[model samples]
Target: MITLLLADDNPRMLAALVQLLQREFVIVDALASGEEVLAKSDTVCPDIILLDISLGDLTAFQVSDQLRRRGCPSRIVFLSVHENPEFVRAAIEIGAFGYVFKSQISRDLVNALHAVAEGNQFFSNSET
Candidate 1:
């Protein structure tokens, strides 16, 4: 099973994500802040990271950069409510394997993760 580490600032959204993904993937941890994610990611060593784009304290882009600097091997997938083309461009620039919109999660998330796990890229929108 694919192992996932999730990070979102909203408790309700975090819980919803866990509930939605737990059956299909092994949720190593679900964190509510970027600091917690940075602190635990190395130890948890999840196969993929489902990170909220707008984390408090540090943006997901910042976290992703730090992770990459640390040579973390986990593939990144940004989950966001934002549909801005700029955000999608930023995710791709950071080398994220996938990007999923919160609104499109039910329709696209599982398939996105599957595609990413297979070493391909996926985006909820075709903006790229």
Candidate 2:
């Protein structure tokens, strides 16, 4: 099973995503902020990180950058409510394997995860 570390500022959505994916993935941990991602990632040593862009105390960009700087190898898949191409570009620049919008989670998140986990990148339905 794929090991995952999930971080989202929104409590409800965070919980819902965990509920949706936990059975399918070995969720190593969940966190509410970017700080937690940096702090707990070593212990979890996840295969992938599903990070919400607008973390409570830091942006996903910031958190991802920090992780990379610290030499964490976990692949990142960014989740956001934002659909801006600039945001997508930033995530791609940061080496995110996928960039998914919140509105599309029910329809796209699972597929996106599956694709990214298998070494394919899936930005969104609109990307292609």
Candidate 3:
């Protein structure tokens, strides 16, 4: 099974995303902060990460940059409520494989994950 690590400060959002994605992946962990992602991710090394942009202690962009610096192969997908182009550019610069707005979860979350899992990048139309 595909393994996933999720980082979101909101418990409800974490739970909901876990439920929505469980069928497609084995959730290694659902976390509330970017620190948690940095701590557990190296050991777990999940196949993909669904990372929230506004993680409590560290931002998702920082988390992604650190992981890349460490040569972590797992793909990072930025899951955010922000639709701003600046965030999109930052995520891309940090090598996030996907940028998904939380509002589009019902329609696009699964597809985005799939695309990222396949070593491809994905973003909403307005993101580019």
Candidate 4:
């Protein structure tokens, strides 16, 4: 099974994602802040990390960059409500494997995960 680490500030969003993805993926850890993600990443060593763009202590981009600097091999996927072209572009530039908008989670998230796991990029329709 694929291992995943989920980081989102909203408790409900985290819970909902966990519920939605637990069957298909093993949730190595679920955290509420980018700080926690950065701190726990080495230990959990998840296959993929679903990160919220707007985090409490650090932005997802910052976390992604730090993880890369630390040589973390986990694929990073940005989960955000923002559909701004800039945000999508930033995520891609940061080497994110996927970007799933919250509004289209039910429709696109699973497909995104599958694509990323297969070493391909997945972006919401609006982003494409």
Candidate 5:
């Protein structure tokens, strides 16, 4: 099973994601902030991180960058409501393996995770 670290600021959304993903993947931890993600990522050593693009204290980009700087090997997959092309491009530039739209989670989330876990890049179908 693929190990995952999940982070989102919205409590309801976070809980929903946990419920949705737990069935398919091993959820190492579900966090509520970018700082908490940064603090626990190394300790938990998840295979991938399903991170919300907008976090309370730090953005997903910041967290991803720091994780890279710290030599953490976890792959990043951003979750966002934004469907802007620039956001997708930025996620790619930051070396994200996948970019999943919150609106399209039912259609794309699991598939994206599978693709990313297989070392392939995945973008929301609507974006492609």
Candidate 6:
């Protein structure tokens, strides 16, 4: 089973995502902040990380940078409400495997996960 770590500041969003994804993936960990993600990542070693870009205290980009600097091999997927072209470009430039917008989660997230798991990039259509 694919392992996933989820990080989102909103408890509801986190819970909803967990519920939505748990059936398809093993939820290695679910965190409410980037700090928690950074703190727990080494222990969990998830195969994929679904990160909210607007995480409180530390942005997902910052967390991704830190994880990359530490040589974490998990594929990072930005799960955010922001659909700006700049954000999509930045995520791709940062080497993230995917970027799925909140509005398109139901339609795109599973496909994104599958694509990324296969060593491919998955960005929302609008972003591309």
lDDT scores in order: 0.91, 0.89, 0.88, 0.93, 0.92, 0.91
**TM values, all candidates:** 0.95, 0.94, 0.94, 0.96, 0.96, 0.96
Q: What CA RMSD would you report for each candidate? A: 1.8, 1.6, 1.8, 1.4, 1.2, 1.5
lDDT of 6 by residue, 3-22 (tens): 99999999999999999998
Candidate 6 lowest-lDDT run of ten: 119-128
lDDT digits (tens) for residues 66-128 of candidate 1: 999988899999999999889999899999998899889889988998888888999887443
Which residue runs does candidate 5 get wrong by more than 4 Å? none
Error of 3 at 121 (Å): 0.6
Question: What residue pairs are clashing in model 3?
Answer: none
Q: Write the per-residue lDDT of candidate 2 for residues 8-110, one digit (tens) a residue.
A: 9889988999999988898888899999999997666688899999997999999999899888988899999899999999899888899998878888988
What tens-digit string does per-residue lDDT give for candidate 3 at 1-92? 77899999999999999999999899999999988888896687989988999998988889999898877889999998898889999888
Predicted candidate 2, C-alpha RMSD? 1.6
Q: State the TM-score for model 3.
A: 0.94
Q: Model 4 residue 5 lDDT?
A: 94
Model 4, runs deviating above 4 Å: none
lDDT of the structure predicted as candidate 6? 0.91
> Which residue pairs clash in candidate 1?
none
Off by over 4 Å in 1: 126-128
lDDT of 6 at 89: 97
Clashing pairs in 6: none
Total clashes in model 1, counting residue pairs 3 or more apart in sequence or in different chains:
0
Instruction: Put down candidate 4 lDDT per residue, 27-68, tens digits, no spaces.
Output: 988999999999997777788999999888899999999999
Per-residue CA lDDT of candidate 5, range 1-128, in tens?
99999999999999999999999999998999999999997677788999999998999999999999988899999999999999999999999999999999999999999989999999995644
Candidate 6's displacement at residue 33, Å, is 0.6
